[model samples]
Target: MTQPNDGPPQGGFGAPQDPPPGGFGAPTPPPADPLGKQPPAASPIPPPPGGYGSPPTPPPPGGYGAPQAAPPGQPPQNPAYGYPQAPPPGQPPTQPGYGFPQGQQPPTQPGYGFPQAPPPGGPGMAPQQGYGYPTAPMQPQYPGPQQGGGKKFTTQMQIIVAAAVAVVLIVGGGIFYASSGSDEKGKQGEASSAGTGGEAKGGEGAGLDGGTEKAPADTKSKVGFQLPHPKVTDTTTVHGSWVTDKAYVKTGVYEIVGYDLAKGTKLWSVPLTGQLCAASRHMSKDYKTAIAFQDGKPSAEDKYPSCTQIGALDLATGKLMWSKSVTSAASGDEPIRFGEVTLSGTTVAAGGTSGGAAFNLANGAELWKPKADANNCYDMGYGGGDALAVVRKCGTYDNRQLTIQALNPSTGAPLSSYDMPPGVEYASIVSTKPLVVAADVGDTAGDGSSISDFFSIDAATGKLIVRISADADKYAGDCGSTEVEQCGSLAVGNNKLYVPTEEHDGGGEFGDTNEIVAFDLTTGKLVGGRADAGDDYTLTPLRMDGSNVIAYKQPPYDKGGQVVSIDGSTFEETVLMVNPDDEAIRDAETSFSFDYAEFIYEKGRLFISEKMVSEPRDPSNSLDDKQYLVVSFTTV
Candidate 1:
């Protein structure tokens, strides 16, 4: 089973409660303020409605102490505290009123069947210990002294199964897919795995009852339901497993409970702490060390409101190795995310609210503080073993422009940085080896119909390598907007770039149609990709050990983005999340998992979130979503 993929969001859903008449796709804007600024030190601003970001004021003893029994006849609920739920995939509400697939559902009816916090068992609800996502825990045993390029790490290659493609005539036209078996029935069981009712103490097959029970000594405490979606509370590379349950280290107040990817067993829970704003964790190229981001309150200075730091965690014991704070005045609310942290040779770099910084990977010390004009920018793509590639936004209001930059990982040196050519924006750096590919994102039409425009970047010097476009803008379903050319998705592998295009339309107004165009990295020519597979195909290239494995979301269903992949000549898209039960899925023939966790593709396998569930008879029964599954992938 899986758990809700994201920790509860701050600010309580922060969107208009009502759905649009046009059917979904509501645009949620970036915060009025950018992220990552030094907090005001003099006097303090009154805390916001939600208890987030406010500097912690000492409460009288026992104020928010442990939970106690409610007085007699009390409802036993805390109305003052209601944590927010995670907005669905792509966190789309932020891009509201724009390019969206018809029939695609919006955030569930605000309080969708689960309580915000009172009944307990929320995804990040650890005991007193906390859990956070993206960054791995501060485990010890990480390496040391990363002042210069001391070493370079590389992984072995991996291989995966090949996918079988077939064509199906749907409403608009014919489409082809690699219908590998991704269990549709089990998807139902996925959502139903947690938070259906108030019954947290019940055993397996425990019907949704409001009664709360304690857990067995040998087993975990009685399981309480959490939000149906699996939250990515905290991720740390464990001993051979790479990623293990947060519970392995410290416990927290409330935690996300879900299945184990390797054994399919239920872990007690994953924790979420208020300290961490956002995070990212990954192993070194050589697999000898690990690096991560920690968006937390400053550990050194109380005068500093909150800070973002880089930390190294031991792969074996889950102990802290070292950590260094990233000081910047860009903004006060910078968001750190998955894939935001990268390790190059011996140096580590992380993107901030507007720019990126390089750090000593082993010691968490600052190697170089490189700056650029990226407004509210946070993720990055790397190329040329020694350089870091980034995109940043500059200026303010309407005059604002976003630009991409490349910096030498060592010596905190500048290599090349410039404004992305117009007509092309929000580009994603796809690869660095055979070639460096970057994607630009823009929106067209009244809504955001986006596309991915590919560019060849010089690997060593970070220059404009080349512009490779198969005229995707000419495609009929291109949505006619410049954004389509700017924001489409592209995957690079085997010296080829797989650029998915919006070919045909189906269902409501727009469709989830995805087409891939492969480009030869060396020749900059159109190399054949899944050209035969129509728009319905969704693909991502991954590296296992060393080989390339292409992962795809299975078809023959609606909505759920379940995955199946082909490693190479061998194929297998049929393998999907196993069913926990039918109640998890609501009425869809092909079972579906809740859209919560973020996806990270690496080493020939994919890692996705898993969740767990329940349904209650009592009106006020369910806990906010909990876990039933944890998203994890692999290749043969």
Candidate 2:
């Protein structure tokens, strides 16, 4: 299905971007076979419910062999688009960590949807429906023609059918669903959280003054690791706040901040980054010895944000263990960015904005770097271990072609690669079972709006394990587009794959009715009918705890968002509060919308960020003010 020659494109979740509007700049392969190549995916992810037309296209093995051990030369540096320079040597590198979840916050109802949110209670603003693209000015007069195909509905047209509808609890522009959990878990298996951090004053995020600047999620979400409350204007690694007692670290911003549930102080504010720095500029996760996320991206250049230095500092003292740069020779003058610099055991696996590299985090030494076709490789996220998933141009949907690389996270040795889905600029989402989830658009005819078929690739060996399709027509009716915008977040947790879709015809950028659906990892069958999020819903895939999956969604039509809990067995729903004052907030009938949606079930909470969308720019007001929503829910 690699009609890479397909039409228009669309497509980031976080960290970096591919070649800009024009042609993709040439890329450099890792020196010394930098990242070792990986086994190719043997199969393709099955098309979603409404199966798509084509299958995935497995890209060839790593184009370039690991680069030869470079001569003792200085690491390459990036030319700045515009930013401060790094400190001289003997100085710490920059820190990178925009850990905050992106999403708009709540405000007094002015008849407008969520607006510039303050810390707790910001200023009052007029509420009016914001800018949105409406396809059908008035609902199409003719009834949808009866049609049937194997493809699951992209999002069936307004069916004349109805579920148990009710006066959904609406308060403070938040929609409250009759959230209920399994009898076994009681209310424990409920929705999201901000993180392992203290709460900010409600009005702390008043800096932005426009509407919500929301973009679809990047493919870097964890299997329930809720992010922190992030801001809209966050340029550098805008790492948002975590839940109470949870700790998160950053490299460029080079600071690890989180709340110590036991102590309650600003847990540990280790000074990882020095003065001038950028976010996600440089950093790596040290999940082996201590539960710390480290950074060294302050020294990252604009182009290569992910290209960074490394230092296993004393979690307590922030003292350096051994500082070394994760450098690569320049193939072309193109700069690079990075996904979360992952540290498995002590090895570091990072996807340079342009490509990716793996190094021995223990000695600050380079292990291996994988080479890519010039301008072929783009940003990729890790699925733990020696596996890295990436994307690029393909069939339709900007040809969101995702390729999974099972490399030696330490030596960058070639393990295997996955068969890539045929599409453009797609992302490889984080997976728990050495699997890679991707957005694959099949033969989309009418418009490039809806996604035909979304795929899930096996990371171990590039192969198609399952295909979640929304490709063809249905007896109910035809769906809207072949884009994944229908689903807010796509992730896997608690042995279940979670996908949330939004159908906002005239609501806003990603506005529409929200639906959160879960699928069995082994089998592509859905857990239950997608949980309804009302007219519009935003979804966040959360981490998993015992037998349950944590997730959250935002309700459209002036409805605040709420967290949800799904019973692995029963697929029940429970609403939790990411923001504190849960009982009080619920009493006040507060709701929310998240920019970055994901749950950190490992820590029992959900995280979200609020940012202002600029591209599909708002007509009336420019979404300036952005706030974050962080909450946690537990099994009853």
Candidate 3:
């Protein structure tokens, strides 16, 4: 089903562009390869004036990197972001916690989906001394269509359907679903304190903290280990991560490697003939998963071979159980190359332009294969988890139609299907069970975020539950333009959707702030409570910890990032781990761009890894650039 060859657009996909018309934070492009060789993503946002790496105006007490005792009688210098500073004389020192007291009224703030007067430096001014990059609207860079045969499809459209199968794998991969017997054993302590040396809070079951990893008596965390970026002549996809009680596994060049979970010691490696192209975000209950890879090693003449091989992998042992490809009359009976693969129950489902198919996870038994159709329909991709769902395409290229269906995990049969509204070219399945789908209806979001409305559907009945209109400029969530299951920075739980508000002016003169707010699934209206990120920190929903929401707070340049558990009912935050303010540690922790990186926080461990890796931008200083593949921190 090779579509006709349409011309590639100028600048190619992911090329950097001017900031969006208004200075709202734009959807960050996926990480580009080193330098400007591959399609370059927007520049690493400029650091705030006098931000990290700046000439210290007063030179934080002990300089940077490590903390030192304060001079006799002088106030503490560069207090870690969450801990409190000394209060004014006579005003009893406030508790040394990162957030306000429970039920305390939050101060009036701006940037809640509405406009307000710009801060001192005007809109989009980078924060001062913040730990992470602040987001603002940048011009959206939509990939142009690539025509083949007689059909035309946007590059991102192909990517949407093509990469859909990996959604569940990414979401469920080792972080959330990987089997860990020790998780339960670790969930015995109360929330950790804010300061590195402080005592733990004295409350039991205070909030539904995420994962079973018990917080340390002191909440401060130190670097566990950091893996350096592998040298690559060109951009390479290394987008897989998994965690187990004993090991932390990730994809590498032409192989998969497993390392000791707590210690970064290499344990095992599974070799492959070609590089990995896609990986399922979900892991099987038995510590198994699926992946797609090229058939042969790349060469100068044929750099990227067809991603025709699908295989099952045993994460515990780094074993690839099986590998094979499928064929359909749609491609004149030749082996069909797949773009994405996912696992649901005991079945492995993969989709591409040739159509879709499923196989038995345990034995590699073909349960179904693609078939040629008159309408030129094809299975674009699938979202697999609590259930299996597909985004099926139909009709001619000019008037394409799309249907989303919840499928029978074993048979590939549609149990229910919902037709997308007219003119909608692509849709992302945010969650399979609740049937939440996101789309940029009428292409109105205009921020390259690839989302405008979130449709909540009844998977059992294929009926719409509610349509939530998400104003792109005001919210921070990304259902990538190219994948149905590649949405991030948002979480769904407790029959509600949690999303971050775009960064806006904090009443303070030097920094910005944001909050995580929930929307009721049934009513599509704003929920009353919000978890504020405090000043100079950006909050994002990571996942659900039963009824609580696990979130990450991007730190201001001088401080370290934080992970917290927000009570779903009260929206109160419990500090889980506050990274040390050691300058070197802060830099390493924030190096991975949140936009294209994968963060798995389980059992007091925060693993930040890149989905793509590239050679150093300055080859001459390749040895000094110090690029990183994975940077891990833990509180245990």
Q: Output the lDDT of residue 96, model 3.
A: 31
RMSD of each: 24.1, 24.1, 14.4
- Candidate 2 achieves a global lDDT of 0.32
For model 1 the TM-score comes to: 0.45
True-vs-predicted CA distance for residue 500, candidate 3, Å: 1.3
lDDT of 1 by residue, 1-636 (tens): 111111111110010111111221222332232111111222111111111111111111221112334568875433211122246888634211112211333433112111123225656653221110011111111111111111001000000000000001000001111110112211211111111000000011112221122112232111112222223333221101234422222111122233443434555433332222222223454332333322332234431222244555443444446665553443333432222345556776654322456667666667765333234333233332323555554543334454555555677454555556543333444443333434323211111222223455544444544444322122211111211111113333444444433223222222223333444444444443343222232333222212223333433222233333332222222232221213333122122231212243322233443211223123254643323233333331
Q: Write the per-residue lDDT of candidate 3 for residues 29-71, one digit (tens) a residue.
A: 5333111111111432222211111110111221112224557
lDDT tens readout by residue for model 2, 441-533? 433311122333434445445555554433122101122122111122443444455554322121222333334555544444455444545
- Stretches off by above 4 angstroms in model 3 are 1-214, 619-625
Clash numbers, per candidate: 153, 201, 30
Best by lDDT: 3
TM-score of each: 0.45, 0.48, 0.70
Displacement of the residue 460 alpha carbon in candidate 2, Å: 4.5
